[model samples]
Target: MTGEPILEVRDLCVDYGLGDRAVRAITDASLTLHRGEVLGLAGESGSGKSTLAYALTRLLRAPGVITGGEVRFHGRDGSLDLLAADAAALRRVRWNQISVVFQSAMHALDPVARIDAQLTDALRAHRSGLTAEQRTGRAVELLRLVGIDADRLRSYPHELSGGMRQRVMIAMALALDPEIVVMDEPTTALDVVTQREILTELMRLKDELGFAVVFITHDLSLLVELADTIAIMYAGRLVERGPARELFEGPRHPYTVGLLDSFPALHGERVRMEGIPGSPPALTALPTGCSFHPRCPFALERCAVDFPPTATPAGGSAVRLAACWLHEGGRELPAPLARSLGSTL
Candidate 1:
């Protein structure tokens, strides 16, 4: 069950360079993550999902900067503007308040360090008052919590299996007991069976630990099962967002419908799948109006000239929002689009 809002991101924008040459990576993205809610950010590669995650945590590298907007973290003490926070303040908040489980465990973990040393490093940095023995005990307990045995504490990253290394990364993220955990494709590169196991363990741990999650992936089918709320992105902007089931069953945006059709149905009878036409537009020279109009099968005349405003689509849930001309002025969606969605709108 989700509680009050814990993190609020408003009109966030990110750019890759300075001045006129800069390419906008994220534009006016906004979303709220409630305490203990699973918020999934889904889009294809280069859709800015990872960029958004990195920006939220103030982990963006040089040349990639937050040009506008606010990211507020509401903690037990008080609310904090993460973008405006100083380096010292960010350090204090990073591991203790919000931690990240990066995409690749091999790249994330120190190759030379033992699992125990890697796990205890955060405790040493953040919980300095703890003695060395106490930190070691916490490391062992964290490993056990992730289903790893204490015997593996002395093993290096190369010594562990792919699944085990990923578990170790998760254990480190939970070591500080953060209020929020940002997982950027945490299950990537693993086999199908291992992916399911990791996802199951993650959900179970979330229930036990009570931390909100920001799960980033390109897999909409996966998000429908794992996320409470799903936000769809295209070319850097959020195109649609709603309850996961609603968004999957009755998507209001053409891009979303296209994505759903691209994936095979896991349970239903086998059917022909169609991929979205054309590639995403370059961020430097985005088309006028809706960025997705070039590939939208149901694009309107206005879609070519005027950007669609974000609005609640007709026949959609009150909490759902989509940015498309078809949904403007409470107009019913076109017949072909409605047929594609397999729902009345």
Candidate 2:
């Protein structure tokens, strides 16, 4: 259901500070988002999911810097280099072209402002042509679009439930009819039922509005159901990316296999689950070679001495890519990985 490429991130890097003390937060992470596609970014916390989203949208705060690479946004009018764009150009593009819904609704929303005021603020800024009344009307319409009643428009953020506040944020993101929306763990705090409702509403809205989405979350299972393409990150690098179904069914990377095995299957019979052992490497003191080699059970000798290049795994789809030695030069997959992937690979 995706169209032509809308956003392309190539070899993007991000650092937390300046000079020799800077911590590398994201490194050479690249992905393409087609129009109307839901590209899910999944990883453990601090794997650079939110950092990448912020960097792509040029929303990274002070002390956080884009060290290298390009972010190209292809809009209807023309292609724009987001990394190189100036403040004025970025202002024009943000909200109007790309919007973001932060992880916490309580923190993202203005505590003192009414939902109506919060929603209309974006319209007032980006949509100057609209009158006050018109902005309010549009806000009401947006609230309704997100399944929020117009009557609650006057309610403050604290007055609404967690889900309602999140929906309001989503409504605000869609107010400008942006081409893309970056959602950073928008449902993390909500109950399972509320999470399902919000996600369902989000997907429905995406279909109706034709907007691309970069959904950042730690939940691979949820992404499996919602995202068209899924990108997996580890130690600030994109280790795997492919069509959602393919990545889930035939994960080629050992780290990916570990992640899948960590989660209990819903339909299958009960079985023992062994999650990834050890912790992610600290950004400041990452291992010399493959960052994950210490924790990878199927790592080769070279994996401890040299970083593996991104390569297409044997029997994987053409678009699939995994940064692991197991898939290099048509080498046979490890027994554990093959068993985990079943006959899919």
Candidate 3:
């Protein structure tokens, strides 16, 4: 986390569809991923976590567009605005400087192709002048890096387990040794134990390889354990961002609080699971002020009409930032909200 940021996203905005039909999937979402650091993106579905990742890499299709903001990649060569990069430049950046592990690793892979071919194809595209032997060797090394044996490389996607498929996707992502990896819910369908193992392995690999990671998931508890920092999003806006443990222990935004409440404590006295009321608002017609206000218990009258500005709390966490009216004008939070935050339940 001490190293310089490998990727810097500033005022990044994304929209889906065209003209009046366009819905804002992400608005003013910004984040920085330092070299070798793991930054977790936690939000409910439709909060634009995956959209932000795809937008960052310029992988959006016809309906999805990057209307505003910049995604800068500061790699060993230099800094480049990814949004403005032409196809040729983008090809050089993808998998060479940055790579992505799609949501469904099984589906992401070519069912017809063996694991070895998929891994080598990435190498062949990016790393030119490599002989057959060299490519095969690199493929083996990559599989090994992800805790997969060389024998599995010959196996087809169907022959491998879900975890193996995920690791294979990860292995392919790391084939070029990119400085950053953007993963979109890479552990979605795996069992709990397998999910934990994969996350642990991913962190270990990140540390060893010295590559930053933008890990997106709906599981806040997993993020708290693996990410160095966590960013909580609601209705496409980042409502809170801070170190993982601090945000988990004392979330500043009501949305974040509700997300935490949804998960049961692993060690402490068990508490009833409480889900956030109502579904996430439709992007086509978002609320006027703070988007979370409709479901936020602490919402004040001002929250209905005025969008809250991002502010650091009075106590001043090292890098905590919350966009909420409670912190506006340096005002202390209402006693009830503060009291609720302090309570174990």
Candidate 4:
């Protein structure tokens, strides 16, 4: 979109638990979200995608601690360090400048309260200048914006359908017209058709409102259609990142290639479903050197002794970055990898 960056996350590290038992859930994860750009954070479960999102917004609870790094939020007023922002400052920024549509929309809403009340409460908390009547009018408009009727404003969360409730959550998040929105698997439980509908509506809204989105999900296939840039995370670290089209066309990292193969081809000759072998390594007991080396088919002798450096892949544009020794040259990659991503390297 060639827009100014609305949010920048640099070297963010997060952990869980006490010293001896601490697990590094996020390590040196960095990316930027431009105005109106959709940056997809894709990874398997426990890959630290959501952790990065939560840590950036300072929503991580006790036991989940941000150990290092910075979250710089560029808002209308100016630049503000989100990690260092105090309670009052955070209160002012959150909801007004940034908001989150958390995973599981059902859990996000209050079962007993009417949808209108939830929407107004957000407005009442952040936008005190709006009169009660104005807030109510805005609530109805928000529902309409999300393709829901104003008549449903009186309906409780439990009374609405899954898609409707999700739409309500989205409405609540956009109530303040925040500059950035963090959506963590916002369409997880919805049907494929419903999920497509919600995402289509979301992108339309984004185009209309010009708000940056940090969309976190495990579905790289879906991101290919919705995201402008995609960042792949593994074992608490970002393994590869590039434009969505380039990453899908020629993924340099073995993990990224495996992830692409895991999903069925939407518009190609049929191919067998090939899932990644072995389970993700536990953060507490991560393997030595590359955390993915234990399972990587292209693992070399050096892969066991030293961690791969995050650098530009061979012949790849500076925009394409990957952490894999294969990109550094000298190591002979597997025949299959060399055949599939030879140009990428």
Candidate 5:
């Protein structure tokens, strides 16, 4: 295994249109994921969590274009630039070097094709050296690995339950033994029971395989259990990043604090979870200075007019840094922010 990161995304930006009024779906978002680590990108809708994941896959749809960034993949074949990968290179790299478990696994599969064919497509595309017999054996092994019956591989997608179909998607993702896997709301469409069960299975697989994971979800609590590091995004920008414990234990940014509040814990008193005021701002017309200031309860004049420089300790990285005014002046986060972050959990 390379000592370098399995996936390194730097200064990545994705935009729509060609001019000043164009919307920036993601802006200067950067993160590094090492093998066996899970980096959770958490936020509300429009936080650009899903957009960034799709960007790494080079699967950006129309009205979504990558404006800047380098997605570097370090793998057995060698390091490759995802942003610059051509059709052939992308084919070789995708599924083979890295794979994505899309949110809607049932939808991601071909409705017209049998499950076996879907899994075989990836195996054939990446591991074509395998004979028909070899591919069939491997396909069944994969189905069993994801906890699905091997016979289900011959069935059509419509024949399986939602959770079973999701398992098949994961099985297909693992077909080539990719070093990194990106999961976008992996259990969104399932019931709570199924979601928990699926997550349990995913965690087990994660520990056993040692592959890195970029887990994109709106649920902060879920991330706490799954992620090694967590980055919170707001209005297309990363507001804060840190080890999961540090970020949850002491969230510096008001937005981060609000997110924690929004999800009241089952164990805690029924404190009112105040949702952040107003919807996310239009990307084409972003608020000046701090993008989160307009909705921030702790916002000050400087916060609205001047962007906060990143603050850090002498050694750095003890707590992942953030561009928030609250962290300045060697002060602790405000009482409300602290209470919001800690009242539960």
Candidate 6:
């Protein structure tokens, strides 16, 4: 998972409109995703996590526009700027270099089409060199790979269960041997048992295939366990990004901490989860200064007036970066945030 990065996104800004009426969904977000690694993107419901994913794959529609920055995708052939990639360029990389497993299983699959056809569609499009027999054989193998019965390939989307469809989607994502799979809440609607099973299979597949995963979820504890690096977004901006162990052991940003508090631990004492207090601000009319300041426990007057820059201090702080006044101007965090952010164990 080391060496050169497979994907480098620099200051990617996605906005919905113009002038004062504009609403930013993803702002100045940058990250490098290496191969054979899982980079988890976590945030609240309206934190633009999904929007960022859509923009990365050129899936954003209508008013949702990628206004600034660059998305550089590095592959074996060379580097391709995704931001500048046209429809034809995107077509080349769609399922081959990169793929996505959407959150809603039902919405993604075609109800009228048979399970085998739906699963083989991407392969048929991207790997058109394959004959019909070859594609069909691959589809059957894919079903088995995802733990579904190959015999069920003839069944329609309505025939399979929720978990089954999700697995089908995963199999499809891996069909073209994609280097990166951007999964957008892949197990959202499934039961806990099903979710765990899917995650286990996904990890197994990743290990076998040697491809990287961009797992997007609002669940912090899940991300902490599954991802090597975690990126926290708040109101269209990345408030924190660091190694999962460092970010979860003691969060640097208030929003990240709030998200952690919201998820119940899978192990240890199963205590009731606390909500993040106020609902996320409307994307159309976002707050001034720090978006999380309204709900922050250690908010200062300056927090409401100016935006904070991301700064990584020396020492073993998990490469912590927080876009809050507490960490701005190379200043030490306030006593409370420091005490909380610097928690031992």
CA shift at 42, candidate 4, in angstroms? 0.6
RMSD of candidates 1 onward, in order: 1.9, 1.5, 1.8, 2.0, 2.5, 2.3
Q: Which pairs clash in model 3?
A: none
Off by over 4 Å in 2: 339-345
lDDT string, candidate 2, 278-315, tens digits: 99999999987789999999888888888888877777
Relative to the unseen true structure, what is the C-alpha lDDT of residue 227 in candidate 3, on a scale of 0 to 100? 89
Ranking by lDDT: 1, 2, 4, 3, 6, 5
TM for candidate 5 is 0.93
Query: How big is the positional error of residue 35 in model 5, measured in Å on the Cα after superposition?
Result: 1.0
Per-candidate TM-score against the hidden true structure: 0.96, 0.97, 0.96, 0.96, 0.93, 0.93
Best by lDDT: 1
Cα lDDT for residue 188, candidate 2:
87
Candidate 4's residue-wise lDDT over 1-345, tens digit each?
Answer: 749888989999999997988989998988988998999999999999988998999999889999999999999989999999999999999889899998998898988899999999989998789999999999999999999999999999989999999999999999999999999999998999999999999999999998999999999989988999999999999999988887877787889988988988657677788779999999979988888998898888888888888888764678888999887755566644444432322
- Give the worst 10-residue stretch by lDDT in candidate 1: 336-345
Give all candidates' CA lDDT scores: 0.92, 0.91, 0.88, 0.89, 0.84, 0.85
| Candidate 2, position 125, lDDT | 94
Candidate 6, lDDT over the whole model = 0.85
Residues 1-345 of candidate 1 have per-residue lDDT tens digits of 799999999999999999988999999999999999999999888899999999989999989989999999998768999999999999999989999999999899999989999999999999999999999999999999999999999999999999999999999999999999999999999999999999999999999999999999998888988999999999999999998888887888899888888888667577877779999998988999999999988888899898877888877778889999897665677664454334522
Return model 1's CA RMSD, one decimal. 1.9
lDDT of 5 by residue, 234-344 (tens): 988888888887678767678888888887777846777787898888887889999988999888888989888766522225556787887677666677545433434
What local lDDT score does residue 267 receive in model 3, on the 0 to 100 scale?
Answer: 80
Which residue pairs in model 6 clash with each other?
A: none
- Residue ranges of candidate 3 with Cα displaced over 4 Å: 334-345
Q: In candidate 6, what are the lDDT values of residues 45-109, reduced to their tens digit? A: 88999999999889888788899999999986689999898889889998888999988998999
Whole-model alpha-carbon lDDT for candidate 2: 0.91
Instruction: State in Å the error of residue 316, model 4.
Output: 1.9
- Superposition error at 86 for model 1 (Å): 0.8
